[model samples]
Target: MTAALSPSESELRETLAQVLPAVRADLEDLVRIPSVYADPARAADVQRSAEAVARLLREAGFAQVDVVSEGGAPAVIAHHPAPPGAPTVLLYAHHDVQPTGDVTAWTSPPFEPTERGERLYARGAADDKAGIAAHLAAFRAHGGAPPVGVTVFVEGEEESGSPSLTRLLHTYRDRLAADAIVIADSANWDVGVPALTVSLRGLADCVVEVRTLGHAVHSGLWGGVAPDALTTLCRLLATLHHPDGSVAVAGLPQGEAADLDYPEERVRAESSLLDGVQQLGTGSVVSRLWNGPAIAVIGIDAPTVAASSNTLVPVARAKVSLRVPPGTDAHAALAALTEHLRSHVGWGAQVTVTGGETGQPCAIDASGPAYDAARSSFRDAWDGTEPVDMGMGGSIPFIAEFVDAFPDAAVLVTGVEDPDTRAHGVDEGLHLAEFERVCLAETLLLARLARG
Candidate 1:
């Protein structure tokens, strides 16, 4: 790596290339640990991953590296001061991942990094561990520092709602100020395209419950008069969308987005969606994704047909997730959604809704220098593939917080994940070639930003 590297620029590329094995090794180690944020069994694993990130930053020439919070899973932060007049760039990634769901679905252990057909499979490997590795490699090859100032904000609770991120940002706004923030937690447009995430949708999560009776009763005696909470809840959920899949919720604000074709067939093919299911929603992909609202009934607590016999059930609960467009108020939207649910009663049953966090989304100004630098870097890194523009349906939430804190800072959302990369699912993987390319891209981006 050192031999191939002539100047600092080439040196960075060479170092990243040389360190690919080790980087992947580290990524594998990080992935093997189930750092599931919401689960009690994985809290310690999440904390350990945070400590590892902090250690990497410290060893890579960042003098000021420590966990910002006093208790719970720490928010890892590190400062790398640059030469005078250079603008600062804040780098952010998450150390935690969604749990290894349905272990039998994976060919290999979810934590063990295994290579098969150019993919490194593991939980969190694609979603974030690769992101962390790329950033660290870039920082390291800059000879323990970037020419421009850098402040790294790696989170420990992204898999969950990221409850601690906003607090940490508020607690350390001044120190975290930067001219641009790089969020490496999104997927690219596809396997070959280097995508610049221009926008992300806001989010709201809730638990919807229906309790019709004190307990279950014999269907033989109560079938005619008894109110079945589960059946009523299912009917209520059905009203959320029509047969065509468009949202049926009334009063939710929606606006047209700049057209992003997003072929329906392509989405279905890429996502491996069920065969016979029709595409839901209205208008284009960008519209349904970035501007309009979407509701997903993620989970339900009900007795299966096989398990249930002849009983009239009294309780039912379901998890609801909503993605709001940029500029939409999540709290207000939540109120509207819940109100809609309450109004549409199947049996005049009592309903309970437990609200979760409302995370706002962010949009980047692509004409800015930070973006220009990224475009060039990405083109070079991906063997001359034109840089692509896309928006994330999933929200990072911290981007909004970062913007509020650093009013003048530019925001960049580019990462190692891509449309082909299956994230948040079993047998998750990272493309090694793309990982190297992203590290190189960051190196070039940092160099350009430093000079400017």
Candidate 2:
């Protein structure tokens, strides 16, 4: 049950309303710069976004700000000392975004921030840019000097698997140490409701090559006798899943049942599934998405229909991504995936699987004082709606690193996106009302922690 809001809470909400316009404007400016870390051409733009975040931190009265890099992508680190006897908190977000694919699919330019009704649309608007803006809003609400100390750590290469994260964390461990940490890279339960991500699925990926033919031959001449590499590769990929779309890979750990019922209608609406398409797997939507193992062929090296000639290809390659639920070892899961692909190539096709990035799944224990404060603050910010503990299907590789680095600190996963935010999709957006609530919640959380 939610308790009544205190007098200070009422004042913070009013302050947030007054400062929201400026915060939204900051988000728009940051979104305008295309900061995609995956593309080498946009590397400078990613640095620009980091500089912009550093400026915002300085403007918000952060005592010390630095743009730190170690031969990879740069990160913005800023610190604000605690008001006597207050605990220090660490805030995490990323400045980089995913590459915009086929911009013609978007209603407006992907980098141009567009506002439609209660949503703000842009490439990075919801994913972590909104997160950066929320941190600024919380700091601005308290006149740039909160009751507790604050450390702002804005990463620059999160979308590209964060290859430099371990090095940066180790180098800056002393500066980033805090009593509590809040990762603003997750999604809310819904528009007006809040959620704390208590568990996250781990990730593993590989590129598999299949060679069925020694050389290309005319389809009309050898189609009947020779098996093309593309066809052979497709058959091998199909063996990873059952006819019902559930993962059929043997020796994988099964996921636990979800406490929340994710309705089919909501999933269809959010995922934008095609008409007449059936939902995959035989379980609740949350269970399949957040807990069970999922496999997808992210990319394939096959000729397009328009550019294809009627010839048997010699080799085909595919990029596969696998998501494992909490309590599963990521390295072991990758081994299982490699073994499954190697044994499933039909007709004695030669197969080679090479593993890529991997991160272990994480489950947070939300029973500490920091968590209690966050729950109370969220309830107050959402007007008596208690926050729910939810599981996320996506992997934040750095979350596990943060857990290992700061074992004593409570890590709270919060965000500004909702069900319809469509992060990393054609038209990514931020729900304006929910964003404001997120800002208010974080501000109140800081206040609550300071009281202790």
Candidate 3:
């Protein structure tokens, strides 16, 4: 049973209101840095972002702040000891942001935070930079001294698939140890709704090349007699899905998702699905999106329409991405994709499949006292709105790494994003009002955990 908020809660609300302006300013400063670790040109910017985060933590009353690296992008670690008999909590976020896709498509500059209506638009505004800001807000709301122990670990390469995460985890295991770990890099249910991510789909990708001939030939001469690599590649890709759009790959397992009311209208509105475009798969919309495996052709190595000629291409390549559901192995999923590509090709086309990165899916058991405290805190912050349990179609493989390195810690996947955040897409944004609630929820969570 939940109890009434104490006087301290009210005090915290007042304190947060006072500190929020500075927090938003700091968040804007953070969003201004193009810290895309995946881009070689932005390496220096990534380092700068890490340094800025370290400085912020130090200013927020963390006496011990260190910028560390594991042969990759720099990550910040800060510590504030817990009060006697209180549990320590670890806060996790990432400073790295995805590369802005097309500058012309943005309503404003991608690096410049702009307020339109009730949201702030920028490249890292919601994806994760707000996560860093949220942590700072909570820390400052307590006057830089909360009841529980606090350790902040802001990663710098999450957008780069966390290439050095395993090494970082192994090297900093002692300093990062905590009773509860909050990974603030997910999406909430909606603008005013809150959610705790209970499961995450894993990721696997590969490049498949199809060769139909040794050299390009005139299309007129080989129009009907010989197949072009591009046509053959298209045919092979078509085999990856059935008429109903479910994955046709063999040996893939289907998992279960939360029985939430995700109607077709909501899905279409969120995804911007075109009118009359039928939905994919046969099961519930949430199940297809969050539980079953999904495959997409992200990119293709073919001549552009403007550069096209009447020549039959000898070879063509396409990069395929596969989303593996919870409880499935990413490597196994990649193997299935590779095997399907090789077996489905006709006309004796030579197909070469090259594997890319793979990350394990994660399923969190959100039970016990820590989860209860988190739920209560969220409820209180949202004025009695119950938080929902949801699954993420995207992958955060490092969550599994955290679970593996610290088996006893209760991992809480909170979010600052709503359906319209557009993380990793053009015009990414964060809801101004909802962000305040996120800060309050996290601030209250730390107190509730200390009491437990």
Candidate 4:
């Protein structure tokens, strides 16, 4: 679908252009708050951020705004009723951000919003914080009252696995209900390009411990015959993938072909892969990343080399994360992973696998009136550039819940992050131009939906 810039569209663009500076300032203010939900010490900061979000929603003309907290974390809920027969759109974002690790590695402070060149750099700059800003900007552009009804749902515990989300959903089902949902917590296709995330891989994690000897022994005395737990764990982890890096786990389904071609050079640059290092798995880059299962050793409990002695360690543990493609049950994948780890320990070593969080994959049907409006709105916002149907390798566990809760609603997963955004890492940033386009797209989408 293509966009024709009618007089109304031009007026909306002008309004957004005039309000862009204030929106950016609001984003800067939000980035200044260190709302890290994963850190227990920052619980107050998370609540503070939620209050800020609630204030923003109220200032943006939401009549009913409340901070809902159910023992875990807070969420900002606001509603702007529709005019006549317009559809209600539930806009979702998160106020809490990922923990900023290794402050020395960052070019600037993670909580201090700084602008260099054409980007804004901070911890939550390109993540869901930008998502919140985008929604506010769009709402402001419409003079604080859009044609369509809007429900602003700004979550506060998304970075911490959203343990309270199910309870929140159940308690406030009618308040959060809508005909369409927009999750602004995903990635764009690239800078200056838009994408609709159609599929997302599910996530499963487990912590596996391997035990060999009862106690540490001298390496020289036991090196020839005794097996170390660390060595055994490493060998077992190696069996999770083939030499070509394809997943060796059974019962996991492969993903479908991606709609766009992800170039190797682009992937290397985006991923910051070292020179001469080969990419993992087979098939296209998108297919390997989004269409197939991937295993990652997230953390390991082993003695550091600096503190290590000439001794054989008795116990070792590793945290493993598995990404399952759409259509695969995450719980089943977790079971398979546990079974594989338990049965693969060599030298009769005892192995124990404990399951962690499991999230289901999501696949959306992007062929409906809502999707058509989104495509056209994006085309207009991006200067005639068409939005692509993309898939995200990472999992957003709450998307599945939102889909289940509002089965008939059109779920549009959009975001402000680009290939170089570096979200959840050091020197995270947001492309200013792309963020403006995102606001414009959302504003135009509301207009289109209202017209229909």
**lDDT of each residue in 24-123, candidate 2, tens digit only:** 9999999998999999999899899999999999998999999999777989999999988899999999999998899999998999999999998999
* Candidate 3 Cα errors over 4 Å, as ranges: 1-4
Off by over 4 Å in 4: 1-3
Question: Which of candidates 1 and 2 is the stronger one according to lDDT?
Answer: 2
Q: For all the candidates, what are their Cα RMSDs to the real structure?
A: 3.0, 1.8, 1.5, 1.4
In order, candidate lDDTs are 0.81, 0.91, 0.94, 0.91
- Candidate 4 local lDDT, 10-47, one digit each (tens): 89999999998988998999999999999999988988
lDDT of 3 by residue, 279-326 (tens): 988887778878889999999999989999999999999999999999
| lDDT of candidate 1 over 167-263, digit per residue (tens) | 7777888888888889898878777778898888888888889999899999899988988999889999998887878777776766776755688
| Deviating ranges (above 4 Å) for candidate 1 | 1-11
- Model 1 residue 181 lDDT? 87
Per-residue lDDT, model 4, residue 7, is: 93
lDDT of 2: 0.91
Pairwise TM-score winner, candidates 1 and 2: 2
lDDT, candidate 3, equals: 0.94
Q: What is the Cα-based TM-score of model 1?
A: 0.92
